[model samples]
Target: METLLQWFDLIGIVVFAFTGVLAAGHKQMDLFGAVVLACVTATGGGTTRDMILNVPVFWLAESYYLWIAAATGVISFYLIRYLQVPMRLLMIADAAGLAVFVVIGTQKVLALGHTPAIAMVMGVMTGTFGGLIRDILCGDIPLLLRREIYATAALSGAATLVILNDLDVLPGEAVVAIAVLVTLGIRLAALRWNLSAPIARMRSH
Candidate 1:
């Protein structure tokens, strides 16, 4: 189980790093800037979660995560130019990373003896914060601040996982897997359909 979780973490790191690289590419950043952004985006969320939980940050204990992010950054920097629409690639990678991180984050909080509510919050933060930081660094409006269904998807998935765990309806791994699928499905659907939350408009007196 630990090994499986570690693999998932690595996958999330790589995909988020790819998204970061795309963001930096969109800004026409140099190689060093791209690498820095990738590393930040890949680890930012989990780092925040760990700090909030008063635990040791995961990347500090595991150097391989940084290596994975760096490698992904270098690879994406070269490959991004070949794509006609790099932003589309960024969205896809972000969705995948978000899904994986949500599950991992919820499980980590639960393992730390936190309540389900706290777990869900951490899960949402884990899934969304990296992209938030990436966007801010790239000079784009953060997706979480937009009317899109980004963080909502993470919340829904995390809530589902918490509910399933409460009911003891499935194995731990199975529950996590289903939550990830739910997140990914919702995010992808939103992207395909241009779904978004209704915007609030202030009426002039």
Candidate 2:
């Protein structure tokens, strides 16, 4: 189960990194900027997860994650010159990456003996921090802070996984699959329908 989760994490990282490179292209960044944003988006969430869990970073344990991020960044950089739908591709890939990461993150936290609440929070952080980092680096508002249903979707899936695991209703793989499906469904629906939380406002001075 642990090994499988690690593989899932690697997949999520690579996918997110690819999308990060895609998103970076929307700006007028140089090659170095693209690669930096891509790498940060790939590893930011997992690095935070490991730090909070008091474990060594997973990328340190296996070099594959590093290589994947670099390769994806490089490929995405040059490929974007010829790609006409970079934004759409980035959105889809980001959604998939978020779903996968949410499952792996929640499961890993549970394996570390944390409660469901902590697992859910960690899951959201793991799934969304990369994008948050990307947005910050790119001088945009962090998506997680918006009402785009991004973090909410990740949290819902993470919470469900923990609850199912606690009840012994599903094994690790099953939990991961269900969680990913739920996350993807909710996120895509929100995107399609433009579902968002209402912004709070203050009276004008």
Candidate 3:
């Protein structure tokens, strides 16, 4: 079970790294910048999780994480230009990565005997921080900072996982699946509706 979870994490890392590289390409950044964004997007959330939990960083424990990010970045650099529908591809991959990371983060915090509230926050942080970093590096507003439907979707999914676990209605694999589906569904709906943060009311001059 643990091994499967680790593989899921790796998959998420790769997907996010690919999107990061795509974002970098859109910005016309050099190869170095693309790879840097990829690394940040792949490892930033996991790094934050480790620091919060005081655990050894997952990438440091396993070199495969670094290798995967690097390889994905290089591949994306060559393939990004050929992608005619980059935004759609990026959105799908980003949603997949977000869902996977949320479950992984929630499970890790739960294993540490943390409260559900803390676990949910950690789950969101783990799911979104990488994209936050990638956006910052690309000179775009971080999705989390923009009040978009992004982090909200992750939190909703993570919260659901915790709730279902407490009720014993779901176990390991089922929990992850439900979390992923919920997150992905919310994300796609938000995109379809063009949902965004509510507009702030203007003050009278």
Candidate 4:
């Protein structure tokens, strides 16, 4: 389980890094700028979660996450030109990153003997903060502030993992796998269907 979680963490870093590169490309940033953004996006959420939890920051303890983000930046700089639909790619990668990080966050908090409620909050934070930073740096509104099901997906996944943990109905790996799928499925469905919560507005005379 430990090795598996490590792999998911690295995968989340890579996915978020690519999404950051995509945001940089949209902003006409150079390779260095893209790499900086990628590293920030890849690690920002995890860093904040660690600090809040009073645990070691993940990339500080495992430098491979930084290396992967940098490498992904360089590779994406060359490949982005071939991407015909960068927005779609960004959305997909962002969804994937959310799924992976939320699971890791919830698992980390749970392993630390935290309650399910705290785990869910950290899971959503870990899943969303990187994209929040990336979007802000790109001069875009953060998706978490939108009416979409973005955070909902992460929350649902966290709830699933927590409920399954409490129930002890499956192995750790199985529970995690189910939770990840729940997140990814909801996000993908939202993207496919343009599903979102309704906006609230006041009538003005």
Give lDDT per model, in order.
0.90, 0.85, 0.87, 0.93
Colliding residue pairs in candidate 1: none
Which stretches in model 2 have alpha-carbon errors above 4 Å? Answer: 203-205
Q: Pick the candidate with the highest TM-score.
A: 4
Residue-wise lDDT of candidate 1 within 1-205, one digit each (tens)? Answer: 6777788899999999988988888889988999999999999999999999989898988888989899999998888878765578789889999999998999889889999999999999998999999999888899888998998999988998888888997887888788889999999999999999988999999
TM-scores for every predicted model:
0.96, 0.93, 0.93, 0.96
Q: RMSD per prediction, one decimal? A: 1.2, 1.6, 1.5, 1.1
Q: For candidate 3, what is the lDDT?
A: 0.87
lDDT of 3 by residue, 89-199 (tens): 777788888988988899889988999999999999999999988988878888777756898899999998898889887667787788878988998888778787675
Clashing pairs in 4: none
Model 1 lDDT, full chain set: 0.90
Error in Å for residue 10 of model 1: 0.8
Model 1 misplaced regions, further than 4 Å: 83-85
Compare candidates 3 and 4 on lDDT and give the better one.
Answer: 4
Output the better candidate (2/4) by lDDT: 4
User: Model 1 Cα displacement at 106 (Å)?
Assistant: 0.8
lDDT order of candidates, best first?
A: 4, 1, 3, 2
lDDT of 2 by residue, 1-205 (tens): 7777777887898899987887788877878888888888998898899998889997898777878898888888898888686476777788899999988888888878888888889899999998899989888888799878898899888987887787886677787788889998988888889998778899898
